[model samples]
Target: MFRKSLDDLLNWKNSKTRKPLIIRGARQVGKTWLMKEFGKTHYEKAAYINFDNNERMESLFNGNLDIERIITALQIETGVKIGTQNTLIIFDEVQEVPRALTSLKYFCENASEYHIIAAGSLLGVALHPGTSFPVGKVEFLDLYPLNFLEFLSAMGNDELVELLKSKDFSLITTFKGKYIDLLKQYYYIGGMPAVVASFIEDADYEKVRQLQKEILMAYEQDFSKHAPNEAVPRIRMLWSSTPAQLAKENRKFIYGLIRQGARVKEYELAMTWLIDCGLIYRISRVT
Candidate 1:
């Protein structure tokens, strides 16, 4: 509910030379909701188009890279007059339609007047290889789980959030119990937006864990549906071992935990796939 990215979106809107924005994150991290809310609050109207299994969208961007034609069709589709100053055009799941992603290049070069934001669950993976991604034509914003202050804001603790922001150590020390209790809740709840929302509303730990498991299952489905066949098993193995890997004292990710004789090379593709899809985070060791 309280996303700091909206502040960055505001900055992007006011900039003189703004390019199309791509909001990237893992599935169910509120990327789509953030884009729509920014549009609702900041603009006269938002034209939202989802490209996931959208056949009409496929036809729309498939024809040519002519900016005018595309804009006109978008106008017809979204029922909002495409305007330079007021309308926010949101291309959701743009990765599903590679041509639409490519068309952003022409939009950046030719139709810079219009504001466009594109986002999808696995857009990061789609931009690699084969797809002619609009490399230099788009700006990117990443949405992550709520940090401590943001979590406070979501729980209607605006004053506490502001106090934390003020960086008053003596004052914070006095509020240790309150902060500690919230921090413990956050530890159990984690930071995924949906989980936070559900927890905030119902305070059901069982439901929260269920939602997380569902999200995990969706990711496994993505592995089977989207990842290469040979790597799927390796991905599952590596994924299943993450808890044990982190349980070690050093907290280093070890390939050996994935299997008795596992090597990095053997599971590198799986790791790369997870990273590319924003499913996992990797902290590299300093050389």
Candidate 2:
């Protein structure tokens, strides 16, 4: 899908002082695909390790975090020979194994030559209370859904993208109708990779709406599963009320909209949780 982040990955690889890389994003924003794609095109080989529901990985990381021993286990699990050069090591859902995340510190300090990229859907909420993170020892890349230009490219409008990039308003004006049509499509698809891909294949508006609903349902399930138990109900309430809140003329968050007499103190955590999960953005009015 031609992510612009691939270019950033290349720069990270070429940096003389590169550290282990961590990609952070919300679920279904294509973190896994981006990491694998980066590895496939940029390295001699890629060793992929998904920590989700893998007992072997859970057991391997539960013990000592000796860098050598961990490398051997990764090679055995991924069936790719471990190397210090020309290999991209991927740690998918590293939050599933907190120790695996802490081990990135060791990788950065000791086995600096090996290229590693790690990602997790719930990194913001999944870590245990005291799990050590590799602060400052590793680099990070924040990924987002495809923007308008990338979305244009994905829809096989590369020439249109090039024309826009050229900044020739006269030339671009000739195709205003085409651009406006595409803008409407992009608005409906809204940059979610799965939704956009489905639209690309089937071009069905009904199917696009279905996919979006499913994604929202998955997120609601995540709230119950991962969010603090006390905040689940409030989160759901705040989330479901968002559209109505935005629909108002003022367009500012009002506690009253969530429920009758709801106060900031009552729903702050719920709002914060949504923001942390990247499910919603909070834009404050300028003072």
TM-score of each: 0.97, 0.97
What is the overall TM-score of model 1 with all chains considered together?
A: 0.97
Off by over 4 Å in 2: none
**How many times do residue backbones clash in model 1?**
0
Global lDDT of each model?
A: 0.89, 0.92
Which digits, one per residue and each the tens of the lDDT, describe model 2 over residues 148-223? 9999999999999999999999999999999999999898898889999999999999999999999999999999
* Cα error of candidate 2 at position 25, Å: 0.9
For residues 11-63, write the lDDT of model 1, one tens digit per residue.
99999999999999988889888999999999999999998888998988878
The numbered model that scores best in lDDT is 2
Instruction: Report the Cα lDDT for residue 1, model 2.
Output: 90
Q: What ranges in model 1 sit over 4 Å off? A: 127-129
Model 1 CA RMSD to the hidden true structure, in angstroms: 1.3
